[model samples]
Target chain A: MKAVERVDQFYLLKQLPKATALLCKEGNLLDASCSWLEIFGLPPINKKQKTQIFSLLPEVEDLIEKLQEAKSFNLRHEISLNNETRHLKSYFAPWFDEKENVIGTIVQTDDITSEVEKEEELNWLKNIMETKMEVSKTGWWEYEIDTEKLTWCKETKRIHQVPDCYEPTVIEAIEFYKSGYSQNKVSMLFHKAITDYQSYDTKVMIVTFNGEERWVRITGKPFIKEGKVAKIFGTIKDIHNQVIAEHRVKEHQQLLTTLVDSLPLNVYVKDLESRKVLVNKGECSYLHKKPEELIGKTDFDLYDREIAQISREEDIQVMKHLTPIIGKETVSCLNGKTTHFLTSKIPYFDLEGKVCGVIGMGLDITSMKKKQEELCDLIKITSMQNQKLISFAHIVSHNLRSHSANFSMLLGFLNSEKDQEERKRIIKMLTQASDNLLETLGNLNQVLDINTQESETKKTLNLKKSITGVLHNLSAFLENNDTQIINNVADDMVVKCVPTYLDSIILNLVSNAVKYKSPGRPPIITINAIKSDKGVLLSISDNGLGMDLDRYGDKIFGMYKTFHNREDAKGFGLYLIKNQIEAMGGSITVQSEVDKGTTFNVYFNEES
Target chain B: MCILMKKVSCIFIVDDDPITVFGIKKMLKSVADCKDIQIFQNGKEAYDALIERQNLGKPIPEVIFLDINMPIMDGWDFLDEMIELNITEHVVINMITSSIDPLDYKKWADFKDRCPYILNFKNKPIFKIEPNDLGCITAAS
Candidate 1:
């Protein structure tokens, strides 16, 4: 090996800033720069002594062997010089002789400590950015207006379902959006942002390369240079999942609204303040207002003060108790008509179990209430008729039994009689008893006829004329009894009544007055008629022996209730008259006093 | 069909129906042996006569056949008046009426507690003198 030219190597090594060194083929250090000595903390080498490179830096032992086995260039490694660690780039090249034969090798070393650390930090930062973009489903893009070049990041390519090396044009990028609204929206925004130097953030629907539709949010900003729009850059985010969830929520809300609006009942939701939040069609029509107009208004705004106060109190009770309140309410309409409703109010709760409002539901029950009242009235009438039937039976039995008993007694007398005259008298009594039995049966049959037959057919008859006809019919009896008949009814007064019932009623009244006359005073009968709203009031009053009403008020109209001792008093006259009046949809009431007079007020219903 | 019982003096028949009174008088003639027989149209007449006889210090009727359902005063009213008058005489009163009404029977039963003079309650149609009925009145006297 030729002698190494240390002077020339020292000059060349001094030109470089890093630590530089040269070693021989035997791996001994031939020359090193002053900076290298300073780095390794080594003293200057003497001319006669040899120091091996591996001994000076033990970290380079494997590197020296690699250089010896094969000629390597620029192989890098790290070594500790002195007590500090430094990273170095090494080169091992052989020097050639004139015959082009292998001579000694040149080992060049460079300290690259700062450069290595900087490159490692750059690589770490790049790794973090890539991971963040993948996790967030985000991508970025840039467009150069002059060159019309579109550049996309690695993440942007993945979002479009494109190959990593694929280059996209501005038109190709716009085509990725769904064809109609989404596509047009993006185009318009893009042009506007460029010309106006505006920035936009929007969500758009895009069809990927694989023909799958996806939702993306694009945020774009345009660069203005020299007072003119130049370039555009933006980010695209995949927001498919978020958009779908929002759409489902909207659809569910619409379904609930439709269900509430179509119910037949009056359905409403009110807030804690008693303000209406929601109302159905029934409530809207009932209030004579539209849903939009009624919303946010309280009952006070739609109803009178009295009704509104009641409604508000009910709502407050529901929320305060957190329970349902059910009751009946009467609502009067604007036309002065009243309606009844069966209403229920329930406390509405939020997701957190707080009572936030009340829900009111009501069903109109006015017609049902009316029907119930009518049913009660029918029951009362039925019970009254039943009582009358029981009384009639008892009267018939008593009258018949009395007559039969008298007949039996007379027959016994006749059988035991020894004298012919006595036997003849007994026979006459038996005949009289049988006649009384027949008469009682006839009266009972007349009473039964009034109960069974309908007397609905009515004819207009003059009141005075009808009374006169009845008086004429009973003229013989009236004259014999010396009864005075005074008809006070108006000549022109007309009444709606059945012809037979009217005649029977007047005749019975007149005969009763004559039959029950006081012994000292002659019977004076006064028949009067007056027109009233309840049809016509016909009063038949007599100055004859009037009964003591207090003693027999309840039984005055009962069958066989005789107040006087007259032999002809069958006691069926007043009973028959009352029944006949009632059968023709009329009522009869009597006012009487002992030895004074009796007045019968018959109220006939007007024919409709 | 005469009832051979002890003789009863001052027998009274009070009724509203003349036929009922005739029937009772005829039946009593066969059933009882009485010295004096008096007839009254209603309870009021009988009651007034009894009160008059008591006031005059005379003997009242020993037996009375009273009928119900009279015009001026019924059998119940006479009995009530008899109790108020405080008649000490031992009169045997029998209520005879054609009425089959159970109410009359119930009212008589209730009155039995107030007036012990009521001897028996008999239904009408006393066709002949029943020895058994006359015996009851005679035994009570």
Candidate 2:
């Protein structure tokens, strides 16, 4: 039997796999594979050599005593020889003789250096990934649908403020979401991702283990195996601050919209191209359209071409200059009615401080404008009354003082005169002066009556009819004087004045024209009138003897001052007519040249 | 009585009111030494006669009684013309008038500063004037 076993051992040792060895109980080598010798960098075995395996490979010598119990050992160990290190794996088992007594060890060895090095590299990568997740406040989660297991990463547990020993079920994970909308929405998305093999990303609110509320962004992606979803996993991020900022921005936009819509004045915003971008309720109502319809429309689209053209040019100027145009008054005539507005426009800027558009506001001021016009008219009337009062005072003092002084002087002369004839002469003079004074007083009284009376009761009358009536009354006299009357006043021309005053004004002007007839030609009187901005301008021109205006300009309207030598020149006609015209809110102006004709322009305030 | 009457070369009275002019003329008769006394109904008439006399190389008026209010031209206008013609330096002007306004005296006060020809101002109705009152019109005291 020994012979047979020896042969088996020789064959087995020769044909053993690589790095195999056999050892006696004392760790002496009985046999070794050629690969084993090569692995330890040993020379080939000789027939005279007696070697133990522990002497060849001392790294596993400590396993010799452990094999005395006849137990098997599998180990990983380190070996160094000739300054070269290697990782080694060894399996040891005791062999038994025929009588069942243990003798030596048969050990198998493997060099597993590459696998251990690869495992260390993988651990380094996992460490870096966990660190990154913690810093970003990000964590991952996985739900195994089959086992109903929920696994959370360490950072995920930190986010929930839970202990590391805490492990949650699928239902418990769903409960972490806030009770109402967040829970329902996350649950629905989770189920959908499971059954439909879909992916989802959403923001939801959660109640943590500590009862603190937070906003988080959850993304889910399903992992399908064999066409069935096994697990769903995604990232969860703490987005509380970003989400709160977004909500505040939305609220601010809504507040501005409400504020703009509440104002009664027209407010609108326009883009760089002058297209309306936003409009308030007031602006929409002004255009008689809804806000949606008014937006993107320009001034040219809403107003008359002439009116809008001006406004567009102004807007362009404002944008180009990057300055504001405020409180511009404008007038619009539409549907036979006039409207006034006070408008303002300002340049609006972008985030970069570049002028982007214009914001405009306007207020209706038509009624205010009407009130201002009425105020102006009132002021005119008051000033005119004050001027009349001053003139009356001067006239009264001047006429009375001169006449009284003359009377006193004449009486003084009479008292000193001894000759009866001289006395008689002085008395005659006194009587004549008294008559002159009485007539002067009567004329002054007439002027005083016209001045003191309130604005006369005015009636609208046709200028052509009034002029024709005056010409008719003086027709016979005009014919005797060889005069020709030219009435050019239009039939549509109308003026507001007291009726008798109108008749008297025409009569006085026409008679004066005939009275001052040039000796070289027959008198030619022409009357014309046209509507003017100031009022109705009536021009009565005459081809008659004209006085030197420069010499008599100041006295042309003075009482009791006559320029011409005519015997009938009373010098009261112009002054009386002036007072009458002023009482009715009218004015008269004359243009004349010596030896030429004359023209009188009478402006009468138009009737409202 | 021994004091000799101050004599003027020629005197001009400008007034629109004839009664006042008549009274002034009668009073001037006391100045026997005066060469001539001219009368005009208005300022323009007086100014025109002055120009005519200047052209004729006749004696210019040594004194003139100017009235404030008148037709055609007024005392102020005549004074401006005299200043414009550079002839005011040769005449003594008395702004004689019937105006009783205090404002009129204020105006004369302002004019008196610039116009040396305005020697005196008197009110109207000089019927009881003493002969000594004619001294203001004399060319020599």
The per-model lDDT (C-alpha) reads: 0.81, 0.81
In candidate 2, stretches whose alpha carbon ends up further than 4 angstroms from where it belongs are: A1-238, A254-393, A407-455, A475-480, A531-535, A566-570, B1-13, B22-39, B47-64, B79-92, B99-119, B124-133, B136-141
Model 1 Cα lDDT, one tens digit per residue, A397-505:
7777778889888887887789998888888777777777888888888888888877447889888899888888888999999888888898899988888989999
Q: Per-prediction TM-score, please?
A: 0.65, 0.64
In CAPRI terms, where does candidate 2 land?
acceptable
In candidate 1, stretches whose alpha carbon ends up further than 4 angstroms from where it belongs are A1-265, A269-277, A284-324, A329-334, A346-358, A411-420, A474-494, A517-535, B10-18, B34-59, B70-74, B97-102, B124-141
Q: What would the per-residue lDDT of candidate 2 be over residues A1-608, giving only the tens digit for each residue?
A: 67466656687685677688787888777777877766667665554577766565566667656877788889887767679777778788887789977888887888887787788889988888888898888999998888988899987887788899999888898899999999999999998998888899999998999998989999999999999998999888888888999899889988988888887578999988889999998887767799889888987787788887887887888899988989999875544566788988999999999998999988888888889999998897788677767766777777788778778888988888898997987888788779879988999888877877765688999888888888888889999999988788788888988888898789888898889889999999988888878889888888888878887886898886776655577679999998888778788999998889888888897753
In candidate 1, which residue pairs get closer than 3 Å at backbone N, Cα or C atoms, i.e. clash?
none
Considering only N, C-alpha and C atoms within 3 Å, which residue pairs clash in candidate 2? A28-A52, A29-A52
**lDDT score, candidate 2, position A477:** 95
Give the C-alpha miss distance for residue A144 in model 2, angstroms: 10
The sequence of per-residue lDDT tens digits that candidate 1 reaches over residues B1-141 is 333655776888888677887787777776678878888866778888988888898787877888877655678878888889887777777888777888999999888887857457888767765544443533333
Name the DockQ score for candidate 2.
0.36
* DockQ scores of all models, one per candidate: 0.38, 0.36
